[model samples]
Target chain A: GSYTTSSQQPSKLLFRQLFEKESATYTYLLADASHPEKLALLVDPVDKTVDRDLALVKDLGLKLIYAINTHVHADHVTGTGLIKTKVPGVKSIISKASDAKADLVVEPGDKICFGDLFLEVRATPGHTLGCVTYVTGDGPSQPQPRMAFTGDALLIRGCGRTDFQGGSSQQLYKSVHSQIFTLPKDTLVYPAHDYKGFTVSTVGEEMLFNARLTKDEEAFKNIMANLNLSYPKMMDVAVPANMVCGLQEVESKPC
Target chain B: GSYTTSSQQPSKLLFRQLFEKESATYTYLLADASHPEKLALLVDPVDKTVDRDLALVKDLGLKLIYAINTHVHADHVTGTGLIKTKVPGVKSIISKASDAKADLVVEPGDKICFGDLFLEVRATPGHTLGCVTYVTGDGPSQPQPRMAFTGDALLIRGCGRTDFQGGSSQQLYKSVHSQIFTLPKDTLVYPAHDYKGFTVSTVGEEMLFNARLTKDEEAFKNIMANLNLSYPKMMDVAVPANMVCGLQEVESKPC
Candidate 1:
């Protein structure tokens, strides 16, 4: 979170941005004081970098109301389970299709209300079968949802790999075109990872510049097929490690 | 070892070459049937791709012999341990400083005699602490060695990382200039990994054109420092996994 000042107005909201150095993962904490309990939401946090996020949450004196994962990340270990351990009372949310345990299994069109702001779950499963994007807005007042948390579904310049578990080039094409690209052009697109420059971009920017997503299904498939040569080197270890949501295992040893 | 035909001649020796598709790793087998009781030597093999190499060896009716790793690899897993496991009597050889379990550990000037061929171990630790290059010649015909298996220490157009364990930029500079560069300019340099177009180069070719090794030590260090920013994403898991030599517990578990 790089926030330097706070808003005094009761109706206004604040969002703190955080980065995980190793994977360059971005985690955001959205807070609204207008809510009765000073509730907050954490999005796509990384494992082991929670202390800093928690400190920001504490400094703002907001109760962690919900912890959500846009999808199970292929690039870095997830911190959902770690956050669950620390903030026991907070509800854990994910897409209903995800295999991981979640307190609230959300789906498309599902609205999660948090005071003056609301998060609308949009099933955008191109990157992975269970991936989703959370559109945050204030309804008519903010007529268009100006922000989206696009997990790994859509990066600034590249779409996620379609060769991983439950990934489909066709599905990804449709998701990007119908659900994401249809969003307001000015809508801010925040992704899970950005290997290249710039942390965020507008929906219009990605539609115009994202090489893979803008291509037709056949062209997209060709690109994906060529990328099949290199499998994730960490897949063998990461998948199993992430299965239990990054819980540090107690070694089995001689008692 | 890309020979196509085998002949029955008391004076002749046979060899076979196998390439692993994933990492483009090459393994070579050299054998002389005049000494039927003696086994052949396997060099720089890759894991899980032994069937092809085994078939070639069987075609020549040669017994499985010794296994050697030019160096501990960073890009691909090595199959020295697996080969030793499958071939009961086969001994594994690596640099003495490698600290892994091997039947024989050799240093520079140490000769490994296998029938008609003599492999001379040359300590080339710039790549990693125990990195070694094997200087081999056509025994009596070519009294002087002409081929060098420079594992990552020297690539076709570049060199290995000095930021890894026991790696020193200064040591690499000395090793290249004082040891490898001192070799005959026409000596063949076969590097362990080549993602680019080249598979091999002459000592003179590398000395004249290699961007890093050809430059001054300070300039080389600056390039290395910048390249180091893109750290191997698999470093945390790969090193520990490779230490035990390519055995993954997940192989036994369901995907």
Candidate 2:
């Protein structure tokens, strides 16, 4: 709730918060407006909304460089593979730990550069084994980063479930503390999913207001262990589909 | 807005209106509850909602018989192929005129029978080459068929545009007048898509109040021609996927 966007925001940096209602997923689009290539990258592109995303890219005269995923999602398939077919030469990037085929295998500290800006990856696996947070500097000319795409490891006032898909409460708690909470207190946090209509949050706000994760490490682990959660409805189809970068399992295999 | 569900509805037929919010598609589940097989049929099952639909079928203790599409959709993939994989023995049904592969090819005047009720097919191709409306009697005890699934042919207040994909204003006008308007005055109409949140309408209501189709033949054609509607965002993906019973085109053939 403490999220803010300044009116004097850098003109060279373009950002948009795109939402897919079916899964309540937020896809972030960041581009360098001043770059001749109009280089753009999308984080967490959804399979169902690929056309809409592609249309927006064409409308902005931006050449998509990377279709990235924060993790192999359980709620919906990623659009990375499909985007590769639509936009020739566009690369699909994901964490090496995800064990999925992609154009680029990223690791912690890896910088995914596009145009004048780059997203610095931070390993924050808790929602899933390959979950990562992407941090980027304020603008092309700014050296200090002020925004973090926290995926599901950290949400507005809560965090992702640590019960399935290689999730660990202790690790999630530690990851949030070391990788996310340690960021600049005012840095903006854009999460992958938000069911309650929250757009963005801040490290300072989440550290103090995130009810589920603000407790001591032991208490946080206990909270996660005792929390009874329902499996997402799309898990069966989404996981397998996402494992192949959004291609249906049957389609990916030969007869 | 005029839609109504009565508690005293006939006990022999089980009916549920399943909605996929992504495409604003309404899938109708109808079953003859008193039959020993409990033969259930779905009209316009969406691809992404297959799990949800399958859950409903299992919970209802009904044996799914057919996954019927009103036409080859251009907004979202159909669940016919996926549903067949999940619910073994379920047949994919569509109009033979659609030129799409399915288990059973239907035609105008065909009767798609389940346990006790049957859906009479009426060719109403204006939105596409093989669009059809399915009309079923209220119940065994009722004398008149009072429900029609009008696909994209006859919407709540407007009909499908005659701008692309074998669409024709003249054919659409003729189909509505002869096949739809002449139905029982009280026949309830369930459209495939409704962006304004309307659930149902009556033949009597549409004839008098449907904004786009109530005019004379020439006026209706002009209305259809002047729609100037934007293409659906998912058309490219949906049409190709649907042509193969919702299988992704890339996955259907050899690498």
Candidate 3:
């Protein structure tokens, strides 16, 4: 559902926030008068909760123009393909550097425009080989992008695992220190998953408290090596299911 | 491998303790003059850790007479089958009420004798179906049990999960109050797994500090239901592998 603001400035940008607390996944739907009927994007949508998202889109009277996956997830199943099936005209986008299959892959420094909204893709491969973060809006004249959707690359108090496929601790260190950490400190950081109780944090908070980022390379590697983390319980089932984007055609069965 | 104690007592009972701090798995090897070659029993043996236990047996010049499982574990694989395979003449025993496959399944009130050492089995199925606690004594003359191996049924400061298969909070409450709590307050409680720093506790301490048992039933159920426990990462791999007793015929692979 849409809520109206009382500001008479005629420059208010409307966006709705939805969160799947179990997975710590945050999906935002941004819309305005210029993109009323056919302009919307979904970032990191979860598989089982697609119905709630679809309801929101229908209630807002907006067409899903694109479904974006920040990266292949290790925690939960992705719903990119499922949205495409339900919303026929929507395009599924990912980093061109990713090894996973996608319909429309864009490279770094690429720009995607839907109505008045402009998204600039930045390739930030630290947590995984093809991880990317989208920078929405251009300069101060445009609405300041006060948010970033970091899919596993960065978390509130911790970082992503670097022992899995396409993972490199060094690359992640660089990605955080150079790209994400350098962002405006006030930028609200929305991570893909949060194991701890934290839901969100500012860039300043992460730069100060993130355990891995604060350690030197040698210490970080030793800490990562000593971590007795078990593999994700759904890896065997979720990976294959996500490869096809939420098992679009497969019959659902009891877990 | 063997240490000598110069105690001038008529009854000679020397016991060696092995501790796996990660899983809180404690194994005991007891030796007496009457059953030198035929009175060895292993408690709470973990998968692939059999080599260490076997080396201790060989060094002490004692034959392994029995291998026992305290309960079907949810966190780690059991090594009872591996011990049985390595020592062909040894008999593997578990509580007859267990759903898991076993050769010699004994019930509650059953007594197992090994020369001068005797163990009385008590059916304790709160943690899981077929869980049993073995009370070991030097002989009938030893009025008190020197040790009790409680597999998941009781922990140092906590209790086992009742959300998994065959687990019941009500059953657990009954098991702890009637069977375990009723035991001598000073009886040593050896648990299967303890992630919290403590290694062991007495029945009296548990009755006083066990967060679950001390609370009312409704409060206990709420605590259990809200426990933010993730599915064990190795559950899928460990369950099937443990079904055949630590992959007897299958080649071992690094976990």
Candidate 4:
């Protein structure tokens, strides 16, 4: 009748994708299988769904380790700050190039480790100057296909709009082509947000089907420029809150 | 860029969860590895998102062989008829007790197989007269934790309402305890619909955390009777349409 925490599953690595409907944001939970303590981390958790996400962690008997952001988001405040406030000792991580405040700062070539699993950081800036993609280990030696957490640089059939927040279409085009597309085609791509109900995609699928990125660099830039998209409704409030490890003024509800 | 179907991955099995937002329904695409033809099946696909679902199936280069419904849903139209129309020769499956006209009728103790993988059919009829939970094999021999496609019988933290369509809270309580909950505690539980943005839960998690079924049978029945749920707006249209293997009069849009 109530939430229950149980150490039930053993030897299975945890990888969960949670959603926040209002913003269509995707939050990822990753953990290592061999770690008895069940150290875990959340990526791109939204402020509105922090309680739900934390309850999940508690129910699964996982110890929250870090709250990670691929970049400073333009929509929906990040849950990293609230998560820290709720779960003491939980650290926040952001890219050093993001120039945002966080407990830990990372850059290209850095690896974030939890138990036996690790994610390689890749500088993939285009939608923003500091966006990065986190990728799990890939190779014939690995047990599973690689996973690439491409925040806004890439999506299922499209890429994020490069119209504001120091957005550059050219940089994004180059960033994805060089950094993300080059990964093994089978690598699972988990974007920070999806609007079309797509939960996941593969590098190969995007390489063949991605509407914007498949175009030449010039064509991609023109498409980005000509598309007169509306300004994000939550950008004004979300960007500021997300910039400082997600310190939101609103205490009760999401902005 | 356009949609591309690449035969890229060599070894990984495919299991994707697709969402149709209007009804908060989940559609599962499951396939067996080791099959070069990439035979696949869909579970509880919604009609409104048929185009999106087909595109995904095509992009993954999976051949649709079966479209199965755990039960005739009341919230949304089933995509089975449309899928069969588009992908010729695809079979539609439903329980025999449902009295629905499908290409194939399955009862308990049956195994639906594709390539090397098979889902053991479990008769968990509580939410409706003909609800079935599909589960991959458990025991130490399986590759990973078993997955139970609970449909509407059992949800993440809740079970389906036993209000209409021969729904009996008593039968549901007994059915879940005997059929679904008795599976391995580590088995992954995927429900047919989720109002909350939860995607997955474990057998143990639901066993301990299920808000409805965790209560005693009498208490569970009382909760079901007192729910005072609104009359389903789509039931009149959805029920009649889902009866004849999901044939719908509306051609262009969802009912």
Best by lDDT: 4
Which residue pairs of candidate 2 clash? Answer: none
lDDT of 2 by residue, A1-255 (tens): 122222123335556566677787888787776688789899999987888778656655688999999998999889887888788988888888887767788999999988777889999988788899999854536323267999999997789998999999988998999999998775778899876544556787688778888899899988999889888999998888777776553353410
Best by DockQ: 4
Please identify model 4 stretches exceeding 4 Å from their true place: A1-12, A138-143, A248-255, B1-12, B138-143, B249-255
**What are the per-residue Cα lDDT tens digits for candidate 3 across A42-109?**
88888767887786566445777887888877777887877877888777777867766666788888
lDDT by residue (B183-213, candidate 3, tens digit) is: 7665667777655323345676677767688
Per-residue lDDT of model 2, residues B13-118, tens digit only: 5566666777878888887766787888999999878887786666556899998999999999999888877878898898989988787889999998888778
Tens-place lDDT digits, model 1, residues A58-136: 6456888787888867767767767877887877777876665566778899987666677899998877888899887
What's the lDDT for residue B26 in model 1? 58
Candidate 2 to truth, TM? 0.50
In CAPRI terms, where does candidate 4 land? acceptable
lDDT of 1 by residue, B192-238 (tens): 76543233466776777677988998998788777744666656655
Preferred candidate (lDDT higher): 1 or 2: 2
Measured with DockQ on alpha carbons, how good is candidate 4? 0.29
Model 4: per-residue lDDT, tens digit, A1-255?
000011122223577788889988999998764477778889999999999999888877788899999999988899999998899988899999988888899999998888777788999998999999999865433325677899999988998988887789999999999999898776788999888888888888888889999999899999999999998999998888988878655454322
Candidates' chain A TM-scores: 0.87, 0.92, 0.85, 0.91
**Residue A14, candidate 1: alpha-carbon lDDT:** 48
Models ranked on lDDT: 4, 2, 1, 3
Q: By DockQ thresholds, what CAPRI class is model 1?
A: incorrect
Q: Please say which candidate is ahead in lDDT: 1 or 3.
A: 1
